[model samples]
Target: MRASAKIFWILGVFFLIVAIAYGFVTGTYEPHGIETVGFPAILALSGLGFMIAMALTLAYRKNSINPSDDLDAEVSREAGVQGSFSPYSWAPLWASLGAALCFLGVAAGWWIFAFGIMFAIYGVLSWVLEFSIGQHAH
Candidate 1:
C-alpha cells in the first residue's frame, strides 16, 4: 500500500505536468475560470494536492493502516461476500467519452463553458468511483 501510494503520487505529478503543458500548447490560458493565474495555477494546485496526500501518508506512516495490515482477515471476509456489483471500469470509459464530448463541444462552439463544467463533473465522478469502489472489488 505504501508503494501504491508513492506510485500514485508520482503519477499525479506526471498528469499535472502534462495537463499544464497541454493547456499552454493549446493556448487555453484560463483554467476553467481562474483568470490571470491560468493553467499554471491549476497545475500547481494539483501538484500541491498530490504532495499533501503523500505528506499525510508519511506523517501517519507509524500507524498506517493498509490493506496488508489484515491481509488474511480481509481475504477471508471477502471470500464469503458475494453480490452483483457495478464494475467501476465503466467510470473511466464514461470519463473518456465525456472528454471526447467536451472536445467536440469546444470545436463546435456549442456552449464552450459547458464542456469545462461537464469535464470537471465527469472527472470528479470518475475519480470518486474509482477510489471508493474499484479497489475493493478487485
Candidate 2:
C-alpha cells in the first residue's frame, strides 16, 4: 500500500508537470480556446485525486503496515482468512439483468423502467441478506 501510494503520488506530480507544460505550449498557439489543454488537465486532476486519496489512506492507517513492506516477512505471516466471501451467488446475474432492463427501458418505455427498478432493488436486497437466510444462514 505504501509503495502503491508513493507510485500514485509520483504519477500525480508527473501528470501535473505534463499538464502545466502542455497548457503553456497550447496557450502560446491558442489563447482563446481550451480544447487543446483539456485532456492533459483531466489527467492532471485525476492524478491529483488519486494521490490525495492514497495520501489520506496512508495518514488514516498510521499503524497498519503491509506485509510486503517488510523484507523479512514470510508468506505464511501474510497468509490468513482475509474475510467472508461468497463462493457463488445469483445476485450479480440479477443485478446485470436489471441493468440491462433499465437500459432497454430507456429505449422502450417507463413500465420497463419501473420493472428494472424493482428487479434491481430485489437484487441488491437479496445480495445484502443472502447469508441471513436458508442454508448459508449464520
**How many residue pairs clash (N, CA or C atoms closer than 3 angstroms) in each of the candidate models, in the order given?**
0, 0
TM-score of each: 0.33, 0.64
State the lDDT at 86 in candidate 1.
56
Relative to the unseen true structure, what is the C-alpha lDDT of residue 114 in candidate 1, on a scale of 0 to 100? 77
lDDT of 1 at 57: 68
Q: Which candidate is the best by lDDT?
A: 2
Error of 1 at 87 (Å): 34
User: What would the per-residue lDDT of candidate 1 be over residues 26-95, giving only the tens digit for each residue?
Assistant: 5654555434455676677677768766875675586656554455446554364456555545565656
Query: Over 4 Å off in model 1, which ranges?
Result: 1-4, 27-38, 68-70, 75-138
Where is model 2 poorest over a 10-residue stretch in terms of lDDT? 33-42
